[model samples]
Target: MPTHTDQVPETPRRRPPLGPEHRWVILGVGVAAQASFSAMFSGIPVTAITMRADYGLSTGELGLVLGCTALGVAASDIVWGLLTDRFGDRRILLTGLISTGALLVLMSLAVVPTGDGRPPMPLLAAGLLLAGVLGGSVNGSSGRAVMTWFREGQRGLAMSIRQTAIPVGGAVGVALLPWLAASHGFRPVYAVLAAFCLVTAVATWKWLHEPDDAPQGGGGTAGEPVRERSPLRSREVWRLALASALLSVPQMAVLTFAAIFLHDAEHAGAVAGPLVVLVGQLGGGAARVWSGRYTDRHGNRRGYFRTVGALSGVVIACAAGLTLAGAPVLLTASALAAGGVLANAWHGVAYTEIATMAGARRAGAALGLEGTTLFTVGFVVPLAIPVLLEQSSWSVVWAVAALAPLLGVPLAPGRRP
Candidate 1:
C-alpha cells in the first residue's frame, strides 16, 4: 500500500473503462445535487404571491422572508466548507441534500399565520432562514467535489455546467411549483421537491467519487490548497471582495425583485412575472457554461471578469431604462439581457477563479468565503431594496442596483495593485 505521504498522480491513476466516462457520471451527480438545492431557493420567487395571499404580508415582511434565507446562506457557508474539508465531499453533499430536502418539505407543509387570526411571522421567518442556510450547502460541498474532480483549465466549463443546475432547478420550480400551488396548493410543491431532493441525495451518496487525483496526504486535504499563499490574505482578497460585493448587490437585487419590479413598476402583467425569471435563469445557465469554457481557454480571469462586470452594468442600466420607459417590446429583452449577463454569467468565472486561486488543496475555504460574501449581499439586498423602494420610485431602486457593477471597475486588470 502506498504511504499517505506519497503523492497521487495528477491525472486519474486508474482510468475508468473506455466509451463510458466516469467523469460525466460524477458531473451528473453534482448537477443533480445543485438542482435539488436550487429547488429550495427557487420556491421564493414562485411562491411569493401565494405566501402574500395566505398571510397578507406587507412588502417589508415579504422581503424579510427572502432576506432571512440569504442570511442563512451567508452565515452557514464557513460551516459547510469546514465540513466538506473535514469529511469527504460525498458525505457532506448527501447530508446537505437530505437535510435541505426535509426542510423544503417542512416549509411547504408548514402552516403559518396561526392562532387568533394573526400571521405567524416569526415561524415563517424561521423556516425561510433555515431553508436559506440549507440552500447554501448546494454551492459549498458539491462545488468542492466538482472543483476537486476537474483539472484547472477544465474547471470553468465543469463548474458552469454544475452551476447550470441552479437554473434548471429554478426553471422547474418556476414552471411547476407555482402552477401546483395555484391549483393544488403548496403541499404538492413541497412533496415534489422533497421527493426529488431525497432521490438525488441517495444517488449522490451512492455514485459520487472524489477524483482519484484529489491532492492528498495521509490526513486528507484541508485548508488553503494553493501552491502559493492565497492572494486573498493580501489586498487582492479585499479587491475581489469589493468587486464581488458590488456585482452581488445588483445580482441579488434583481433576483429578489425582478418579477415584482416588472409587474408593479412596469405593469407587465402577472403571467409575465415568473416567465421573466425563468428566461433570466435559462440565459444565465447557458452563459455560465459558455463563460467557463471561455475562462478555461484564456488561462486568466481578469479580462473576462472586467468585461462581464462592465457589460452587466450596461445591461442592467439598459434594462432599468427600458423598464422605466414602459415600452413592452424593449423591456423583456433588456430584462433577459441583465439576467443572462449579470445574474449568472460573472459567477461562473468568479467561482472558477476562486477555485484556481486556492489550488486544489484550499479550494473549499476559498469557495466558502466567496459564497459567504455573495450570500451576505443576498441577505442585505432583499431587505435594503424594499426599504429603498418604500420611500422612492422603482427607478431609484433599480438605479441603485445598476451601480453595483461599477464598484468593481477598480478591480479590473490594470487597476489592481
Candidate 2:
C-alpha cells in the first residue's frame, strides 16, 4: 500500500465563513442571471408574430428560427455542465453571460431586420443558436452555485425561487419584446435582451461567490460525505432526469397552446383563453415556491415529486376528458390551468433531489442532464402538437399530454432519496 502521506486527499478547499446576507445576495444574482437568460430563451417565441413579419419568414422558416435556440441549448448543456464541474460556478456563469450578451449585441447590429433589408435566414439562425449555446451555461452553473451556497435543507426553497426566474423573465420579455419589435424594430428587441444579459452579468461578477465557510468537494453535507461518482453513471440521476422530461410534456402543452385550444377550438371569448394562460403562469410560480418550502420543511422531496406527478396526471386526464366530452369552455379552461400549476410545481423539488442525490460535487452534470431533457421536451412538444392536431383533434393532443406525468410517476427515485 502507498504511504498515507502519499495519498493526497481531494476535496474543495475550505471557504471563509460568509455572512448570512451574502448567501441571499448570491441567490439574487443567480435569479437575475437566470431571468435574463430565460427572457432570451422562452421570450423569443413570444415575439414570433413580429419576427415573422419583420424577417418576412414563411411558416416553416418561423418554426426553424423558433426552435434554433432550444436546439443550441440542448446541444451545449452537457458541455457547459462539464465545464462547470471543472472550473466551478462563478467562472462558468460569468463567462457564459458575458459571451452570450456580446453575441446578442452583435446580432442586434447585423442579423436583425433593418428598414429595407433582412439578413439571410441562416445567419439569423446561427446567431440565435450561438446565443443559446452560450446561455446554456447559466442553467447548470448558477444551479451549482445554489447547491454550494445553500444548505441541504434549504436547497429546495432556494432552487424553487431560482426556477421562478423563468416566468419572471418570461413575463418581462413577452411584455416588451413584441411591442419593441412592432414599434421600433427587431434590432431594438434584440438590443434590449442583450442589455438584460449584460446587466445581470455585471451583478453576477460583483456579488456571486462560493461561501468562505463552504467545503470544496460540495456544500450542504456534513462530515466525511459519501463518495460520489459521475452523474452520467448514476441510475438515480438518469431516472430523475428522464422523469423530469416526461412530466414536462403536459406543462409544455398547456404553455405552448392553451390559448389556441381555448380560443380556436373551444370558441371561448378572446380574452378568456389568454386570461387563463396568465393565471396558469401565476399559479404555477406560486405553487413552485410553496412546494419547495413544504418539502424543505417536511423532508419529503421524493414523495412530493412523485405524488405531484400522479396528481397532475389525474388533473390533466380530467381536462382531456372534459375537452373530449364537450365540456363548457369555462370548465375546461379552469381544469387545464389547474393541471398546469401542479405540473410546473414539481421542478424545484425534482431538481433539489437530483442535486442532493448526486452530491453537490456533481450537481452541475446532473442538473445539466435535467436541463437537456426538459429543453428537448420544450422543443419537441411544439412540433409534435401540430402533427397531433393534424392526426386527430385538440382532445387527442390533450390525451397524449395527460399520459406524460403518469408515466413519470413510476420513475421516481428510490425510497431513501
Q: Who wins the lDDT comparison? A: 2
lDDT against true structure, model 1? 0.72
Tens digits of per-residue lDDT, candidate 1, 1-417, equal: 779779776774764542325668778898998887677576565567766676778888888876887789789986777667667678778877888789877766664333445447777788778877876776777777777666666778988898888877777777787787677766677678788889999898778877554456411223434454643474565567557767766667666677677667667666666776777678888888888888788665767777778777777777667657755744644664454445677777787777666666556667777788887887888788888887987767767777778777666334223
Candidate 1 weakest lDDT stretch, 10 residues: 217-226
lDDT (tens digit, per residue) of candidate 2 on 302-340: 888889898888888899899989998889998988987
Task: Report the Cα lDDT for residue 413, model 2.
Answer: 82
Best by TM-score: 2
Q: Model 1: what TM-score?
A: 0.87
lDDT of each: 0.72, 0.81
Shift in Å, residue 110, candidate 2:
2.7
Q: Candidate 2: TM-score?
A: 0.88
Root-mean-square deviation of Cα positions for candidate 2 versus the true structure, in angstroms: 6.8
